[model samples]
Target: KTTTTSHPASISSTTRGLSAPTASHTRPTGPTGPSEPDPGPGSPFFFLWASPDNPYESESTTTSPPGMVVDNRIFEVLLSLPIWLMVYFCHSNVLDLYRKMPKSHKWAFPWLIHLAMGLAAVVSIVFGYARTHHIAPQDVTGNAFVGLNIISNSERIGLLIFAVVALGKIPETIRSLRSLVGRIAMEVMDIESIMDTTEILEVIASPMLLASATIIALTIRDLAKITDLLGSSSGVLLSLVLPGLVYAAIYSTPYLDIKDHDKRWNGHRLGGFSIATFGVGLGTIGFLATVFSW
Candidate 1:
């Protein structure tokens, strides 16, 4: 869903190598809604959440207040944001990375990598939830070492997989931020020369950006606050809305140099609008959930 006018070369390396683990890193935090009950084994959406037997279903002392109005269904709906956010991260960045590839490689590698990453993400979610879902939410909440503790105490390896994936994301994130900043600069300043001097700019800007980010991270009392904000806004825009809008615009009228038939464009146009509309609703819900959940 992310759009970028920057030279795709800046991100192609990350797209090629980092996706395997990055996708896995994202799946554990994904959300599920009340409407979509886990359909059990063989169902397509089962990978999206843990088992249908939610630990929160019962009125409990640890997880929820007694006689709550909506029961645990409300928690299910609120937890659904991370899955879409994962989609946003994976889907939006792929376009830019794919554009950077030579036409020969474009049709094969990037797509295969995306598919592989998606599969890996699903696997990660299944493995993660299968192990940790038994634990009460209150036990894990605000516990930064939960994963470490889980690994140390048990033979379960789900958290171990996540640890490896998270490590892989560190470099990818650094490069992505640098490229994103450079692209913004190019757009705002109208300086095409900035791309030509990208490495130089990175040398100067990287340290400054890192310092600024470090400062912000230190100052923030709750890192999840920022993550929730970004997930609702940037995540939805890039993952769902922008892609739909771009597709619709490209296929409309003359159809952006693509020589596809009118019939195909008609279906694509409708699908694009549908996706965008869905994104708007999803984003609104996600935003409200984030704000009120606090």
Candidate 2:
């Protein structure tokens, strides 16, 4: 029998070949330590109303993110509109035609838009004094005014916009809508025809002052949590005087049988009063929740 002895070079080559296969076959180790997840758009609190089952959260890449900040947060947490409104008006091409119109009409649509914005800003400001600890009229005692959510001065501008640039054009808007829907062709209403200066002076402004006085009294202890609820507080107070006006106007409409109408108007006023009452209740609940959260 002829015995063959393996050379050291051949043995080393065989060992190297074996090691290569072993190295390639084994699984690679993943990153060490605790796994970190992506915080996602905006920040950790970006997705309020998060749903685990919602595919959109994981799959969809681009969408308007939910906000924790006041700028992106829904108005009083009831509805989201302001940010979208600002974005669309600022960047959208739908208003291109409006932009190209003659100087007078060019600003007509924009003026209406600005008025609505001003009203919303005013509502936010008036309510800010109530809901926010940082914005109270005068810090009385304790840490009641020192809230968890501290808004900056830039954010504070929302409070100031509406007070100066009010619309006072609710009547105009209603008539415009009626004409647009009811009539086949809408006529361009003149400035005088659109504005009821009489109602602005008589019907709206007086009660607005009254509502302001009442809300100021109520906001003494920061009980205005859901600010948007109080947005219509003034209107509700205004509505309180409307039924009496309806009663007064019934005599003028001689042909129409307004005995039932009078009862209906009474109910309408009661409904408005109830709504105003409920708004107060909501504001109180929200305030308690903010101050006394577990």
Candidate 3:
């Protein structure tokens, strides 16, 4: 009876040692526990990632949608088109003025002034376009765009010099035009000066004719949107297609006789080649950009 009444020693020891579990022991807690801290003003990640602040985490977590960056860049690039057209118009007008000068005056020191003036107009247009289009120096990512901008800037400087020289020659040009006009009028009144006056008039008219043609072409192509058709083909078509076509037509015309005998090619031919090269290069760059872009 005494042996049977004795309690098991193991069970008694385990019950005696055990105590109620504490909060720290029952659950392993975080350093700050389960409570969230209030957000501060300076934390970007807090605003971007946290709940309650921006409940739409699905939308907020997303990056810019596809093509958005490319679309923005293309928009900026295309915005420069009108400004470039303006520059082309100004340059064409200046060229017309230069063409009107007498052949004797073509290589004269004063002709440099006309060249400078034309260049200035071009430079102003380019820089203005760049500024308006937000094509800042910092925006150029690599050698290509940077090179183009540099070339543009150099052209501007060259144009400034040409314009200053041309301005100085303006007085000379006016005097020449007036003298030629008076001589022609005198010849018209007297049949004797007819041949001489005709020759003089021809000299005076050559540059004017060329200048006028150039300006007209510029107006038609750049101002009138003749180039817009080609734009659908490629972005470079904006700069190359219409101008090339117009110049090609001019070179082919019998009236202009722009082609040099010895060279067997015309200014239009050269211009076309140059423009084609530019268009090809631009296309290549655009293709690369499209391919490598994220």
Candidate 4:
């Protein structure tokens, strides 16, 4: 019976030889678990964030064809510009009128004018849609589209009201114009000099009213055509650009002593401009929609 004990160095060497081979064998296979990839350019998430394919890349992606979105937005803005300018001018005139009126008469007129304009706008919107869509009488009976028909009819009624109200103002407008002209004639000898602030405003108002009337008439005659026009690029330019130019001219005129002139330059003019811009945007959108539909 021999008692042979292994030396500490021999035992340690044996352990190291076995462990070194096992470690070397395992390392060549690389990681045992799924390894994470680098956040590279090829990554889908990275591409989505940085590339054009991503809808979230631009604000206009809510609509198709990024270029169209920009164009339509511009058109819609332009279309709405004139209305905004008219509103501003009307408001200024109303304020001037109120200031000249007795305290008892002031409150009613302002509210009335606002109501009239609002009614007119609502009517125009409704009638224009209804006439263009050509809603059938039978279609309204227990149909899903009935609501739209009703809305269209309601708009027509609103237009009627607006027209009535506008017509009603004719007498007052005439009186004011006459009085203004008389005052101008008494004050100055020259034709240009005779045209005082009020007379000049009246002149502007007359043309504005005539233009509005023509537009309204055209809209009434062929609302579909008007809608088509409004949805077109040219329509947007007419609605927005022309009006904006007119507003800019009026706003910049030193001779016109419109109240809050400075305030208008700072604030109200922006609103007018915004409306036109909105028209441009809408027109562009409409055009794109039409084109894509085809």
Leading candidate by TM-score: 1
lDDT of 1 by residue, 19-77 (tens): 11111111132245112111111111232234344332442222222442232343243
Checking candidate 1 for backbone clashes, the offending pairs are 1-92, 1-238, 31-79, 31-80, 32-80
The TM-score obtained by model 3 is 0.24
Which scores greater on lDDT, model 1 or model 2? 1
lDDT of 2 at 143: 20
Ranking by lDDT: 1, 4, 3, 2
- Candidate 2, residues 153-222: lDDT per residue as tens digits? 7545644453222233333323332322222111112233423553465477557655764675466435
Between 1 and 2, whose TM-score is larger? 1
| Candidates 3 and 4, the one with greater lDDT | 4
Which segments of model 1 are wrong by more than 4 Å? Answer: 1-50, 54-56, 59-221, 253-257
- Model 3, residue 86: distance off in Å is 9.7
When superposed on Cα atoms, how far off is each prediction in RMSD?
14.7, 25.0, 30.0, 27.9
Question: Using lDDT as the measure, which candidate wins?
Answer: 1
RMSD of 1: 14.7
Which runs of model 2 end up more than 4 angstroms from their true locations? 1-202, 209-213, 216-220, 223-294
Ranking by TM-score: 1, 4, 3, 2
CA shift of 251, model 1, Å: 1.9
TM-score winner between 3 and 4, please give it. 4
